[model samples]
Target: MAKNSALIEPRLPRGFVDSEPADLAAVEEMVAKIRHVYERYGFDPLQTPFLEYTETLGKFLPDTDRPNAGVFSMQDDDEQWLSLRYDLTAPLARYFAQNYQDLPKPFRSYRQGWVFRNEKPGPGRFRQFMQFDADTVGAAGPEADAEICMMMADTMDALGLAGKYVVRVNNRKVLDGVLQAIGVADEGQKLTVLRAIDKLDKFGPEGVRLLLGEGRKDESGDFTAGAGLDPAQIAAVIDYVGGKVPSGNEGIAELDAMAALFASAGYGEDRIRIDPSVVRGLEYYTGPVFEIELTFTVQNEKGQDVLFGSVGGGGRYDGLVSRFRNEETPATGFSIGVSRLASALKLTGNLSSRPATGPVVVTVMEKDRIADYQKMVAELRAAGIRAELFLGSSKNMGKQMKYADKRNAPAVIIQGSDEREAGIVQIKDLAEGAEAAASITDNAAWKAERPGQYSVPRGDMVDFVRQIPAVAAWMEVNARP
Candidate 1:
């Protein structure tokens, strides 16, 4: 006998999750809506591989405490290093540079796929997630960035999130200019200050002040080293983040142009607005940056009410593609965090929570009648109804019914020896039967009532099954264009 320890445990990695049918359906619905918005804005679909040469992704990895930094890296057969892409934008830059000659000057495209990160997962954070991104390469003007913001606003509206979300816009150059004005010249300290500003909403000004000077210890007593700055430098940084300081930086000019475009399009402050605290943590963002912050509040696992934070954000990376070519290739884009947005929608009751209706099950009544059962299934599918023929080991009627129920099947078709000889099939409407069974007191009365059972001619099985509410609803939803 094999030892129990020899068996491999069925489990998933900590930062990964399995998508059930309903989750897949919700994501599909969201993707379709987002695609519609992107297409309406004249963006075409593009796709890239999951892995790329690690160098091709550039050295800009997200800040993480893990040893691997942020990406999952591996050595290829030829000793070249390859990594699972940390974001869709880097792969896009590589693709555009390689195919620059044949492509149009201002390439407008959208990509949707899974991106991996080698970071610790907590609560809503995961190592692998989906990002739906739209980018406009070769466009340096702030208008390209403005259009992206408008499209993001439209996408939220299309997803029925109107008035519940706000697109906060900012400029990295504005923050950079602020750092220069304060005489903070060290690159490491500059990055630390930018990240501290990004955490204004989470930690408030006092917590950020500590991050700017020395460091702040969390409730868990883990001390994080901060940018060592004098009181003057810390106060300067705090004043800027509090919107107490204004600048005449070029980034400010670009933000002004974007703001004008937003007004011209009638996208009021409620939909999109300029704010200083939106310094996206990515190092590649050179100019305008923006983020979608959900304004709604949800109860956390600790039962405390907290505002749902950013679901997606991105900015211009004029320097990203320049690494591949001598001349600069200005690119601006944003990504929608599909999984995070889906989770928020699920919590707010905007996403459908009902389990997806399964196929119409054709139960095998006789071992010899398997062929007949398959024929019925084929006919139902031909009529655009989802269905399947039971291929289980048991031939018992009770066992077959139990199997269908487990499958969430709408109805089950039964043609026992007597019904087969009579040229008729019995259809048991599981959905209606369950509803009626809840009201009936006695099991005998429930069986006698046979609430949703129907008998029809063998040739009429498909048509009768299609009339069942659950099956008809499924067919209507899944109809081909």
Candidate 2:
């Protein structure tokens, strides 16, 4: 049969990629650790939908000029614009407002889900990515922000990144104060200046100076329009980012309060520090902002040594929920970029990159006795073993073995007519067999050792399979809460 000429190509969009089993497993592990920390801090889990009204996301959409600017969106049949959430915080604001009457005064919640962005993808950037966030709504004190910073530090410690990461805290108010002090009143120019300051780490002082002034061009010759700040304004912004923290303003007072709380809570500068440069990129941040930055240096794709920078960040957004409600609803939270953090962990050798093991596959040896093989699988499953009966067209033992190996299955169960008559079943430990094959050079010895193949009573098959070292270890690890 001739294949259809117009078979659509199988591919993902540039900014997205499929998560394989191992990748998923790594993310799951990281998320679990983060969840435990959040729960320990008394944050309950809350989940919002993947889509929200375009306006509900606040400034991301509903623009007739560029409906999908920075966010994926579409108009519904009823002519209402809906958009995939760009971040978890916006949805949380909507949710909190919608359920304000029933919710507690200070609603503390944590959520983890995928967020979508309609932006250009680059190294470590994706159109769809997972973020694990914890937020406290209705909390107006700087202590709330301090707790978030400390929680972030604890989360890093929980992830085995104890001394390798630091929670850098700052205040948007402080940045605003500096801008005010510099006599920059235009909101557009203020945002441009803040964005320039945010790039202090990515580009050094000179690069940021260019961004604060005329503009800067990248290695690809792409020009980015700057804040158009005068020399004096640029110098002022640079001086502030260079650790000359401003005082006397509410921002400075809040930072001082947060710093006191941090010291009282025993989080030293190594774990959590008051950094003057951590002005988060988000515009909604009304006050304190913080970021978790990995301190360890790693070689980039170009083999250049660079610090694995901010993996996660968040800040107080006192105005987000107010858009939904008539009253002021202050909120503070932090988000961990699951994919980026996983990548960092893998590079730092903290995240496991091992191939995921598959379930135990029971081979269908005799077509007529397929029921018998299935029964064995059921027994294994009933005993809490991950087992599945192989159902494929080829009945050849070699093909069956190959399938089992490809699955990375710890072992495979076989019950042929002869073995059935003898009331015995064979279990092959694939991992052990591969290891033995590599070490045992002689075919004779390989056959004699039968390294990982075992014949046991039919009734004891489940127990024998469970005893395989690889299977045993996997079960033990998975059995934990």
Candidate 3:
């Protein structure tokens, strides 16, 4: 007798998700649109490995205790520590540094891939997610930053978010000046201040003030230690954040310069604007930073309406590649969280509501006549129609129809003995049947419409199916020449 086997239950790690075909299709559609916009702006596609040497990917994440603190890391057999890339930008920086001599100046490239981070996951916050990035490396002027802002606006418009979103722009230099004016010059303290400011939308001004001063206790009574700044320092930080100080004035001026750059290129404030509160949470950003925020409001779990918030952000990082070489290499780019953006589109009803439909299924009525069914499926496929033959165990007609429905098949090719003897095939429009059955009130009219099924000669089966409006429209869009 064989020993009893142990069955292992399949599971996915927290913050990771598996996508179904419909979800995958929807995401692919969104990515294609974004990629089109990037390509239009002359950005070429590039890809990098999921893993990189820990030393090669320099430590730049904000609020981390160590270099690989925020990333998933593992040790190789050769006693070298490797890490999963926390963001696409880091790998790009490594690539540029390694091949600087052979690459073009101001190398323009776009990449779309999954990035990993090791962090506590929350609602809509995953450890692994897709990011689409476009960067101009080696461009050192505000013009490059302005172009990125403009391209971000265009990308949003391409994704059908033209009037519903705004790109908030700011500069790190202005923030640095603000800190200098406030007497809070410590590097760790600056990060603490940035993090507190980042919580402005959630904690509000008063809560943030508490955080900047002593500390803050949330509604759940969990305390987040403050930056330990005095009252005067807190006031200075708050005034700068509110754009009421000299350094704040300098930040506003820089934003105005960027806005003018955009306007000269014909982009207006409708798409991009300067906001002092826009401090991106990344340590590597040395110059201007911008965030794409959706202006629309949605209800949260607490049943209160709130803004959709930022879906993407980027800024100039001149020091990333400087770590590799002794010289500064300016680069700026933008990245959109693919899943979050898709979720926003869905919530706003901008995404397609219909689930992706599968191919038409040719039912197997006569098991002995499987060859005939295969022939019909082949003809449909050859005519640029998506179709498949039933390859199930059940031979019952009712079961076959149920299987077709389960497959989301638009229609089913039926050739029973009677239809075969009549030298014809039946094309049962399952979609039409469901729609008609749901709405038809008059039995006589329903019978007269014959909305569910049609019969055509065996030789004309493909042509007849092609004439159906739904199938015809699909073919017009997806069929190859």
For each candidate, give its TM-score against the true structure.
0.96, 0.96, 0.94
Best by lDDT: 1
Q: How many pairs in model 2 have backbone atoms within 3 A of each other, for residues 3 or more apart or on separate chains, i.e. clashes? A: 0
Ordered by lDDT, highest first, the candidates read 1, 2, 3
- Determine the C-alpha RMSD for candidate 2 after optimal superposition of all C-alphas: 2.0
User: How much lDDT does each candidate structure score?
Assistant: 0.89, 0.88, 0.87
State, as a TM-score between 0 and 1, how close model 1 is to the true structure.
0.96
Better of 2 and 3 by lDDT: 2
lDDT tens digits, residue span 1-481, model 3: 3467776689899999898877887888788899998999999999999999887767687655565788888999999999998899989998998999999999999999999989889898899999999999999888889889999999889889889999988888888887887788788888888888888888888888988888899988999988888889888878867867463355556567788898888887888987778888888888899999999999999999999999999999989988888999999998999999999988877676466767889999899999999999999999998899999899898899888878778889999999999999988888788788779888998778767898889988988888766677668868696
- Per-residue CA lDDT of model 2 for 152-217, tens digit only, reads 998988888988999998898888888888899987788788788889989989999999999999
lDDT of 1 by residue, 1-481 (tens): 5675577789999999999987888889889999999999999999999999988877787563332367899998899989999999999999999999999989999999999998879888899999999999999999999999999999999888999999999999988888898899987788788788888878888999889988999988998789998999888777777776466789989999999999999999999999988889877899999999999998777798888989999999999999899999999999999999988888777788677898898888788878888888888888899999888899888998888888889999988999988999999999899999899999899889998898899988888888899988888889867
Question: How high a TM-score does candidate 2 get?
Answer: 0.96
Q: At residue 424, give the lDDT of candidate 2.
A: 95
